[model samples]
Target: MSTESATHLRDESGPFFGEFGGRFMPESLIAALDEISAVYEEAKADPTFAAELAELHRTYTGRPSIITEAPRFGEYAGGARIILKREDLNHTGSHKINNVLGQALLARRLGKTRLIAETGAGQHGVATATAAALFGMSCVVYMGEVDTERQALNVARMRLLGAEVISVTTGTRTLKDALNEAFRDWVANVSDTHYVLGTVAGPHPFPVMVRDFHKIIGEEARAQVLELTGALPDAVVACVGGGSNAIGIFHAFLDDPDVRLYGYEAAGDGVETLRHAATITKGRPGVLHGSRSFMLQDADGQTLDSHSISAGLDYPGVGPEHAWLSSIGRATYLPITDAEAMNAFRILCQTEGIIPAIESAHALAGAIELGRELGPDATILVSLSGRGDKDVETAGRYFGVLDEAALAASALEQNALDANELTDGEAEAGELDHDAALTAAARQALDEASSRVDDLSAATGNGVER
Candidate 1:
């Protein structure tokens, strides 16, 4: 079973994965966390719990997500085959479902009737809401106000799935702020609420448990790739934010000496400009969000703001396990700039017709470079963590698709103004008051275009449509 070797049959002295990962939390919450840890252990031992989870994976969440080789997309990557593990096909359209379902089940076993979580791009929030709806639990998700605006579609998805979305406006109004708000809620509602830490970053048990839940990703991919190619891949790649998806897919290959593991962090503008979220590449070890890990902080040790085109990857700190993995030299961590990531995103869409999440696009960017370096004979597996439906608006704006529509609309308005024989002053300033109407029309055009693009993307299954 995957559970047996997810982190493998190893014994550790405590929750610390090296000098990182510990329960650095309030005294009030320690007992609750310990109870969660104990319950998870007991659940792992119980055949019934395992069987139930396995059934859910088989029927509900779609386990053993397939690996499809991207030959056409590989052409640009120096002819090295680009194989993708399609977690995007999972329930709720992301790898997050795997962890949330497991955690929700545990929450049920712990006699909890409510679930709480934090989201940046809203993938985790949607997954948590899905699980909550399925299990008859009330769900509340904290999202940064900025993220709520950026990923407004996902906010709608969460609400439609029966979850309350709270917008956190403090600080930079991003992931860290949402995280702070969630923790405060958990502290107050610990009695009847299970705080589902969306990533593998929080304190001890969450980092361990979330990774364990998702490790099946790598386990399945490892076997499927070996059977298909008759050898281990040259490299396994994933994007790192709070690092759950990366660790999930990387854990299975940790013992495979011949396979190289790589994690790509988001570089918003450029790391040189200090506007990126390349935590491991340029950050220092510090405590944030209850774990000691690589964090973007100032000289005075206050956490700094992190930026990324992908809201999911715009985080200042990463999971402690990633910090430990980078420290031990087991995996190489690097940066992928926003422009480069969008380039990969465009290429994948045009070449393979696969619209990957902006977060996953960072791994795609890395895969391109790795493929070029490794050449034609090499094989690289990238974790396509989610579908891009939630990102269509952002992508349209980034690629200027929406802008083109706006320009056309503006031209039409100008033509109408000309037909009305309006003076230059009337057109540009006073009488021809079509500014608000044009703006509304542009917004509608962008939304319609984004929806159409999303519909087109849905045609692709695990890979390109044949």
Candidate 2:
């Protein structure tokens, strides 16, 4: 089933999705990529390969991810039925496990003993490391230096799973840099290492293969939605980075012309500003990471630095198929600013008691906007792509929990200093009790923040919760 339904609409054999996808890689890696392509093509046709992979999904990766209707959350979004595809519950805590497991299987088929990958939010890295450990393969993950700091929890998880995590510190020191480093590493070590690209980008069969691996997400969701609602959903939504997860969930609905597909890209501050990764929304087609796709490039076609609060969406280029979809107007791509995404992030947590990754929050933000546009009768299915456990630190910092902690810590240190009679060299003068005074500063700040929240909640009973 899902395989037949997955590719029911278009051709997957060609190297191009319209005019956007093609092998724009180095000569040194063409043969390696071609080898991978051929192997993947063969495996795709082989029933045994499909059977094995399906078994893995069924037993290990957890296939048929449930879709839960968020009635409480939907009330905030113009009363539109908001159903969430719970990919966040998958075994590596994201839809990333779907592609990683399949790639690892293919790598085994190709006799590769190592898995090389690049990650942005580190979910992909964690998934790759997980599959590597499961299949007894060595794993190396490259991540941007900036991402490593924000996603320290995932970095620790990767190392604990036996992956050697390399922090890439080039250019913007984000996803693009890490991808560049991973490609370089793959080119040098193609003999025994399989570059498990985490998304539906890169060269030929990868976009096809990775999407095929994840199409089960849409396939299951489609049937589940129909079973639950007794009709098709009015729309489907997902956040797009290199575009694997979006493609996975979007593919099954492509044949249903009436079902709208919406992809949300990261707009760090605003699209008007230079700091955004809304590739499909504010980009032109250009080659990046071995394929021609919508890229944030300059007038002279040079790649531009992209920024987003979500490391996963901080890429300058998008998957080629997404370029095709946008070009054809089959799907709509929108920019979700950091503020919008964070607000939605807080809403989903307060409303549904589910913390989502910042990347997925973009889609949540879009859903609210789209739901209002479509009104109460429509049903929108949003992909909760990943859990927020790996993102808790970043979110906490964003919400000022870290600032509060630092203030309290500093206040306590000041108290310790005052007790030691070393209060800024005013010990003998005794001008003030530095401990209580400093602690009060922190307390005052905390009180002010609490008061603000309380004031808003009092004004509108539902304001603080959502």
Candidate 3:
């Protein structure tokens, strides 16, 4: 069978393939998952639930994000036509809100009083917090200590929205660590708290639930593309962090046999350096973060810390759905390096006036490569997963504005810089003066971020008060 038929052959009901997506949680949480599953099943069948969600989408979360044609960026891809699903325009500034809102609604239906989630880049944290605030539910977010520090602004954003942020200092102090903390919290508080997973990974219900929530991305884009150009796209492209956005768009195109699907994973420094997060492209089957999938591990089967310029994709294992998709030959997984993603980041900024989250840049980079192969007439759709506001400092450092010499002298130097080593005048003249530039860059970043957020809010009619 062709890839399309194979994907279509599988129904949305039961019979999850190969035990890849069965509930693997502690016995305590099984009842909650069962309750959630039942509620979801009812919601799926009931027109009232569907209408309410549709109303929220139309008024709260923004359905039907725009499909923008990137002509200039497409030129580098051998003149192939390239379009972007502007999920970055979604409320909370990423594709994350789509899943969060849906799950939050599900939580409300389940009669849960609190929402809990784990985050790395803080995008999901912010989205979850936003939903909780909207629904008037209590919220708690667990983030790795390192991520909390690196993404302090997001931490503050969540706090401002009345969500509690706990910094997990265990393990590698990243997404996995935060996830461990969240899982522990879930096991302890499963009855009253709903764990809103950010991606289509995780155990049983999550892979299916998150995917169903995100499927709107592809559903809306499919119709939009057809309306805009009168035909199906030649291919769909998305960055695969936990494979949420990729699966979202890909699910819609699964039955469209001619429409190719490509998912790009992060290759932090360089895959050749062995210091990367290209899980699907450079990993083995192993268990990590509550799911069995492609994982970066050592000879002893111990999980390895992953590196990526994009914190969102800095994970050692990918979503189980992605693993199954790859094994079934339904989708192709590729790796995009930090350098390539950064380059694409700048290209989108310069050419299209769009600054995508570093994570989304990976897909943009892949689009460039695939476009070249497809040439000018072919149409490819890429998901602009989020905005880049949360990554200015990292991007500046990667782009050399915050290089070693500058870091040694800047305000960010702080404890690392010796005050006596440089005179006041010298310190003032050197990296410290870079503050104005940093501030300007930060403002621009935030402005871009808010614009995307507003676009999503407007589209979804979510009416984000922020």
Candidate 4:
């Protein structure tokens, strides 16, 4: 890699990166999308809107999230200097907050009364609910049944934030299905509800708009790295599910030829097997969630199911920009297996005292590989996208760190910790109304899920379509 700058930007003529992104959705959504696009374009140009958003970033979402050098962890990575962009330290404990706060403000600007979103690991759901609570907007989040199970604490957190969580039981019970449900809700309630997309994927304006919201990750990291190292990083590494954080960090460095960008995808067992979500590495261009992108699909063109130990990265499609970036040789994408990611996750926790989201762990694994190949003295900047508290149960099971008794004890300790975090007065006033609504919604969703499961079971046994 040469220490030279190579600059490029996506085409502004339309909502596209090369031939990738565009409005490939139902006509019913066009007006809503156009409205959003127009408003966002105006907001982007207005100093007042920019000032307000900047203030929110500073006081509300914690702007300029610090970059921490991970020397201990770097010891394991071919002695390369590893630095983490600490997005995990932000409010809501993830980079998701950066986008949600912007979108929530936009939603309020559009006079939307309700906010709806879909989540996989529930980071986005929790972030959206937090923003809704802050903005006093009604909120609803759709999550896959399997995801709700894997990320139960986040489901609880979203509920506690006064968001109704709907469990989608259809089709693999994961992010894609939940997204389908969210879009359905958005179309029906387009007049009053704004769909706060969780990532840099989806239709025309969404791919562009969400990426704009998260660009701060790269902008800040770029300035921070330059000040700390007096040079740009050798590689900018981030995990790619829907590719938000990766794109966020990658965008600013795209014009810097010397800064290599690498995106790691979740390879469950391996990409050669049918059980991974390495879309850019193993998939072809296809339409999913209204955007043309790399998608895991069968010969018949049906989308294939994606699997990963990390709920966040289990998706068949990728953000369209990732596909474009790969095609133009601007960025390199690779796969990191579940075992590889888990090992990196444990190493970071033990060595650096940083428990990263399993999704971010994929990037850590990639950085390790890149570090070895690039040799010592190379600096790798990895996006620590979210905190791993949400994955403690999953990680505990993976590492056998928590047995049944220990798990129970841990749960009790967590409950107590959460209780102590709330004041007696505020808890009494908020918990009553919030808990009642949350409990009712939870029960209804569970009952509906059970009924669907029963129906599926009956249909399968009788050889009928459900």
**Deviation (Å) of 347 in candidate 4:** 0.6
What total of clashing residue pairs does each candidate reach? Answer: 0, 0, 10, 1
lDDT (Cα, 0-100) at 324 in candidate 1:
84
In the range 28-88, model 1's lDDT, one tens digit per residue, is 8899999999999999999988888889999999887888789988987889999999999
What lDDT is reached at residue 244 by model 4? 97
Candidate 1 clashing pairs?
none
lDDT by residue (1-466, candidate 2, tens digit) is 6578344555444488879888988999999888988898799789999999989999998887889899888887889999999999999899999999999999999999999999999999999999999999999999999999989899999999999999998888888889899999988999999999999998887788888888888999999999999999999999999988899999899989899999999999999999999998899888888899899999998899999999998999988888988988889999999989988998999899999989999999999999988999999999999999888867776664444545556666766666566655555445455555666776776676566555544544344443
1-466 per-residue lDDT for model 3 (tens digits): 4565446733443325443445556777778778888899888988987788788878877776788999987877788888899998887899999889889889998889899999989999999999999999999999988888778889999999999999998989999888888889999988789999888777777888888889999999999999998999999999988889999999888778799999999998888887789998999877676567788999998989998878899888888878877887879999999988988888887789888999999999999889888889999999999999888777755554434334333433453244434534675666555655565555565565555544544554322111
Name the 10 consecutive residues with the lowest summed lDDT in model 2.
Answer: 457-466
TM-score for all models, in order of appearance: 0.86, 0.87, 0.84, 0.86
Superior by TM-score: candidate 2 or candidate 3: 2
For model 4 the TM-score comes to 0.86
Q: Tell me which residue pairs clash in candidate 4.
A: 6-257
Model 2 spans with C-alpha error above 4 angstroms:
1-8, 402-466
Clashing pairs in 2: none
In the range 1-466, model 4's lDDT, one tens digit per residue, is: 1222124453332477778887789999999999999999989988888888889989988888999999988877889999999999999999999899889989988999899999999999999999999999999999999999999999999999999999999998999999999999999999999999999999989988998889999999999999999999999999999999999999888878888999999999999999999999899998899999899999888999999999999999999888888998989999999989988998899888999999999999998888988878899999999999999989876664535444444545555455555545574877666555654555565565455555555543321111
How does each model score on lDDT? Answer: 0.89, 0.89, 0.83, 0.89
